[model samples]
Target chain A: MGGATFKGGVHPDYRKELTASLAITAMPAPAKVVIPLQQHIGAPCEALVQVGDTVKLGQKIGESKGFVSAPVHASVSGTVVAIGPYNHPLGRKVEAITIESDGQDTWHEDIKPHGSLESLSPEEIKAIIREAGLVGMGGATFPAHVKLAPPPEKPIDTVIINGAECEPYLTADHRLMLEKPNELVFGLKIMLKALGASVGIIGIENNKPDALRVMRQAVEGEANISVVALPTKYPQGAEKMLIYATTRRKVPSGGLPMDVGVVNHNVGTAVAMCEALHKGKPLVERVVTVTGEGVARPANLMVRIGTLVSEVLKACGGLKETTRKLIIGGPMMGLAQTSADIPVIKGTSGILALTEENVDLSEPSTCIKCAKCVGACPVNLVPTFIAQAAEHELIQRAEKLHAADCIECGCCSFICPSRIPLTQWIRLAKADILERRRQQQK
Target chain B: MQVLYAVAALGGIGILFGVLLALVARFFAVQSDPRVEAVREVLPGANCGACGYAGCTNFAEAVVGGEAKIDGCIPGGSETAKEIAALLGQEAIETVPLVATVFCIGDNRMAKDLFVYDGIQDCAVAMKYANGFKACTYGCLGLGNCVRACPFEAITIGPGGLPVVDKEKCNGCGLCAKACPRNIIQILPKGTAGHLVLCASHDRGKSVTLACEVGCMACKACVKACPQEAITMQDNLAVIDLEKCDDCGECVAACKPGTIHPRRNLPVAAPRPQDQVAV
Candidate 1:
């Protein structure tokens, strides 16, 4: 169809077949849940419930007091057991509220279905999204309302729906498309209306033919909406990449999609919006794909946030004897966990386990300057140079090489023949460069 | 006549350019604080952001603007701090020279292996698998996160699969300590004799001994043997107060497992033989 796409992207083995065909199942509540305060990108929300406080499911347990934070909600009806430092997925102790489940699974009685998206105004929708504690479900965990509210000068012209489930070994978005296509379409329309945009485009990877067909049919005859199938590749769902692939536009460095008259949201985020607007549901649960060679059975499950990885593993027929590594999200960008005690957050799309044979623990080799990382970079950045600068502690040099522009899609590390940890170094460089800039300002 | 004509033409062109430049400079001139530029000129220009600024220039501006103090740059050492203090017309503040130290004593022999790591060699990545292959959950993963984190090439993975810091090359930027997920790397005072505790694990005696052969058991033997009483047990970890230490090498001899040792004038600790190591 001669669809628009950006240059320099790679295609990795998408092992989504392990659980792609499975229907979404509701996971039984875990015995205990550990809800971290800092689940989103900005400041951690302050905990409202202390030790011994009894809370119901969907109750707001943590409240956002800052401009760039998201509130936390209780996923189970339980008593707060502790509120001090607890083990977090980011490898440090953070203030987390531990809840001992009462097994009642009772809602707070205020969550009633609002019936349709047409009833809510843009401001009302934004308020509901904020109150529901909704964040970007595309593994970014950015506050959803903040994305909706751009500065008055930056007028958004186009709203793009990112249906491109490009990461390998994850198909939560694919399942949503096949099952909840109408909800996704409704949510897209709501987002476009809220942004005051006249047009919307849904960019789906060509790999998910069924999802594309279903979504295309759902949006048929809608004047302001269209669906475009992009070439299958890793990180096609990244905001800049999606904007570039669909509209042939380049978002400037250190700029957002809205800077170029566009805004993009993941399909899962759209569905979450629909739920928040229509069903009056907070973001307590999300679809997580439980799959890999290490599981006895693989399936997609709607799991509550703060549920333990061990609980999800148990629901998916427990781990096989050979299960060696547990990773959160897809294999490409997922963080390998220290233990199964870590809780699922809004950004978690999948829980993957790899057997001893499937797991790659090979020692990293020296870079051969293959420039595969360059070819694979959707942003046209030179990852190897950034890694080199970071290794030499030349952070300013790394910034000059555009280390801050790295999206950390794990494309460079994934495609590198040398198995060099390019993304990790770039991440460190980005952090240092940002900190340096901040310190300069202060 | 031709020479006169050429000279007149040249003179006319020069006059025109001079007038235009004056007009442009007068119209587009930007008014900035002269003190900011003056302070920037006096800075060490390392732009290390140790002063909590984006760069040396930014730090200079902040200091001139009264937003920051004089003693900000750790990488610049005390001399740079004194220069900055002089530029600000403030009394010079005394500063300590800091250095990075690897707290883990877990080598191949001391620490047990979980599995053979063959993937991307990064402590952060290695730490994804139940705290890497090290039997001590708190020990260094030896994937060289600190090596990668060091901007000065001060830290490197030695032959024993543990990080070794070169004190001479270390700038004490504290980047390695922050980069560590296990938080084993520490920035301590680079003492006069460069002697300090070599172990960092806070685990109790038996568990520490079981996890790694060379781990600090917190037996307090060193604390008792110190004539200056510089060593104290805090949170089950023996911390040697550098201010009180006299560098007598008494703690080194008193340590039963040889966890505490002098950084200089000590025999090079050899790596355990490969065949004797367990997978």
Candidate 2:
């Protein structure tokens, strides 16, 4: 089918073969876990459990008090050893609950298997998703209920399922599609029902032919749902790119996908939604693809949230002796973690351990202005200009050049011949600009 | 007669169009707030967003509407704050003129090298691998992140592999502080003589002395030696209270390890010769 797509994107080397063939395996639980309260992109959840408080698996350990927040649940039955400031993946100290596991994989009494998605109303579905403590799971970790509920004036007509795991060395979604195709499709239908959308489109990259075939077959009988294989490209899963790819609609600058009558969910998020609705389960565990040259073993594992990254690395047969860098997500957009003590969050798709030889540690040179970043940008932004403005500390000028519109897909930095930290600079500029804008309101 | 007729017809059409334009302008003219325009005129126009607004105009509007205070611009210094205050017909608040100061004194001579850093020259990149090439993990990586972050070309890397601040060119912006991965660059008040602490390290006496020659050892010798008693120990670091310091250069003399050096280019009093020093 001739599906809609966006303009201006680059095809990076897809290195999914390392873990694509590996089926999902449940990793052994760690003894201690540090679950951060401010994992999502909103107000941090307030801690409901104190030190020494015993928490069951899937129990609400932290509760959301504001509109844009998500609740945090315990990944294992454990006693809270500490509920104070701990090391976070962002290289700063944030409030986190350190739990010492009891070795019992016990669930809370409230959790039970429900009948079907048809039984629940829109509000019921949203409550279930919220109680499940589900976020975007697409790396942003924005509250799912917030996206499901658009403003009354703007209507959502279509829901897009993003199966485009475009980042290198990540194949969690690809494996999910290949192994649990029915669950992914079930999740999509639940999301569509919750949003009250008429149509659902699962957009997968052409590189994942096996995933496409399996997903296409799963949706064969459904008239309202269809699967579309997009050209293999980076950031095709971004909200703007996905909207443009499926519906030929452009979400305006500083606007959301709902502005163009659409909503998008990651494939993992869809699966989580189905699990939440049918199994009465919370988003306690997620599939994480652990792969790279530094790792002794490369495989996809269903890991519980709040597990220390060090535990995961150990479970993957530890690291090779030369492992130089430990990243929490895909290489392109993942944050290089300072400490292995940090816990896995809802948005973490992969834990990549790269040796010194594998990591791109090349020195950054002067910008040659090759416009490679401009050519690679799917949103048609001038990344070079933004990086230049950030370098010069001209954050306002950077904002004027649409620095805030940067999806931070790392396309510019990935394609730059100068090896400049263009993405990092732009992120700093965007933060500065946003902070400045906020200060003015006060 | 034909030429005169054509000229008269064109003149009439021009007059009609001019009248229509005038009427449209009169009907659609926006009544802007005079206070906002007045406040905006006095702003520095940098629109750095340090004030938390999109631009100077938005800040001015917020100030005029009484939604914002006049002293929110950190990059504008005290002069701009006074100008903004005058524009709003409010009393000028005495705002501190904050200048970025590099806290580390561990230059090439002070710190020991680890491995020859052959990878990315960024402090952030170097930090990802074994605390950079310095024996002191907290020492400046000398990748010039501050130099790159400076908007006004106020900071540069000296030959000793440390950032040198050009006080003359510095506009007191805090961008350098944000850019430093080590958080060594600090915004201190640009005091009368530009007096401030130079040491950034918080390590103990022996370890700091071993790591870098100029690191603050938290010895408290300067605190005891100061006549004005301006220095205080906080977080295992000696900080000079700028308000109390008389610029006597006593602390400089008292610091045996040379951690509290004078600000660059400050006229330091010459030390007396040993024979002449005897009273």
Candidate 3:
């Protein structure tokens, strides 16, 4: 269809040309891999393997009792050197399994294909997806199975493959769309079948016409599936935004995509699902776009899950001499990394090293009643009022402003003329509000 | 004559407004208990939410409403509790005075600086810059976010670039605890005899040594030396269970980096070095 769009999004300079045309290349696995147990947003997985144990590739190293959590497996056949807290990309020390690879690249004997999609039931597909430990590869890292298993009351009728890749400077999804459109379509069908959805739509940003053409040709014969091009905008690929853009359905406040009978998955996540069910492979490696002005080379490389960010940076010919900010995903919403010692987890979409010029490290100034942030907020919450309440530690006032409804897309911070960190304040307020509610419950 | 007529009309309107205000007050007045006022008179009036209420007035109402105990005013200690108990015909409960303490010992001079973090002045925002500026992630960044959060102006940034809590002025409102991004500020029972571990780092020995000189290396020296069995090794950090602690300074002496802080200003030496040896 034509360009479907969302509301209240900023037009960030999508610097995708750095790696959009480049093909995905395989980066050599590092000697050691630090697989964090708490990769997905849920209860941390308990370590199933211990130090000094020889673990085969694809062997489950960590498993969680919580349904919201997914099991973690060894990306490489190696010996567990340590099972302790390690620095994670999420800016905290988390329990991780550090394994020293034997360089054998051996696969486990249990790694066998599960055959065609026609044979597996929806429950069986979800079980396989869970066992393979697939999560949203689009920087969210939400467990894939959890999204697939919507409540019986909220039956998802449509599944949308999110190939928008709206975040600037991230072309992993773009490269996937170009190189493996068939796999993307196959993965979407698998998800749709698992969700028992009749209609499956792949929503892509119009900026990538090449991707749209390739995806269109891939799903041309499938009547139940279609390709819809979305106008390029920040947060367009966000679950709610994408649902709104394609299907004209607005996910209610404090609700999931399933609330409007829709389920969304990243293109990378779809590819991983196809590999899991069809090839009997697990989510071990993902396509990571290592690009920025600071890097000597800008290309998308298929990287192992537990590889150190330093290794990937080295493969990109290392950072420039004036490199300053090392962002994990995109400059807009990505985390500013302090150290390169963290390993690439399931959610690392892009590794950017912005030089001194690319980064504006200026301090925040006073807010001048501009209301620019109010109009730019994708969630449409009064960001400045919530920020003020949060700054003054007025939890009651912030609660009245619906601080918990913030999606934290960083739109307010990006569009602010005063350069105030409004989104961060809203984030803090949201946490405080949730904490207050939890304490009151206790 | 015209001026007198205008003045007379305005006076008639003013008398009517006064009578209307009196009637509105009589109808809208909340019939609160007389005990609420008596309890509030004895309250500390700090409005420090130590009792989990909104303010002293709210705490007073709760006490009179039978929703709260008379001893809920933490800053008032037992004296105000006794007064409120007497007013409410209840027993006064004893409470230990509490004060906030900065738990991180890695100050500006000691902690390693991985990068020059010149971000927003907020500790929470700065923490978003890779957990914090201090190489020791658990250590306080010493940016004075606590000073800004203190409602009573009880905390100040010391010369060491660390938050120094004035125990006398701190009322254990837990606002500093809320303000701290690293959660280094803790409300501890105020006592001169009690000791505290001044570091929050749980990093392993090598990493801790690399990050900060005074970070707790989890050596368990204090745990082994404590005679009262108060200190325990938890999550690779030394946690003192204050209930069992009797203010013995044994663990303080055993600590090598001087991370264990014995209650200062007390005569902990028992006898002077010169008096015992030189004499």
Runs of candidate 3 with Cα error greater than 4 angstroms are B1-32, B35-107, B116-120, B124-131, B136-140, B149-279
Q: For every candidate structure, what is the RMSD over all alpha carbons to the true structure, in angstroms?
A: 9.8, 11.0, 9.0
Q: Please, what are the lDDT tens digits per residue for candidate 2 over residues B1-279?
A: 999999999988999999998998999998889888887887888899989999999998998888877777777778877888887767533366667778887876667665555444689767765567777777898899898889799998876678888787886778998989999998776745635566677777787788887788888888998899889998878999877888888888878778786654432223334563211
- Give the candidate order by descending DockQ: 3, 1, 2
**Residue-pair clashes per candidate:** 11, 5, 0
Better of 1 and 3 by DockQ: 3
Candidate topping DockQ: 3
lDDT of 2: 0.83
Which of candidates 1 and 2 reaches a greater DockQ? 1
Residue B171 lDDT in candidate 1: 74
Q: What stretches of model 2 exceed 4 Å from their correct place?
A: A2-4, A393-396, A439-442, B1-103, B108-156, B164-197, B201-214, B219-231, B239-279
Please identify model 1 stretches exceeding 4 Å from their true place: B1-104, B112-159, B162-197, B201-211, B225-279
Fraction of the native A-B contacts that model 2 recovers = 0.00
Candidate 3's docking class is: acceptable
TM-score of chain A of each: 0.95, 0.96, 0.98
lDDT of 3: 0.87
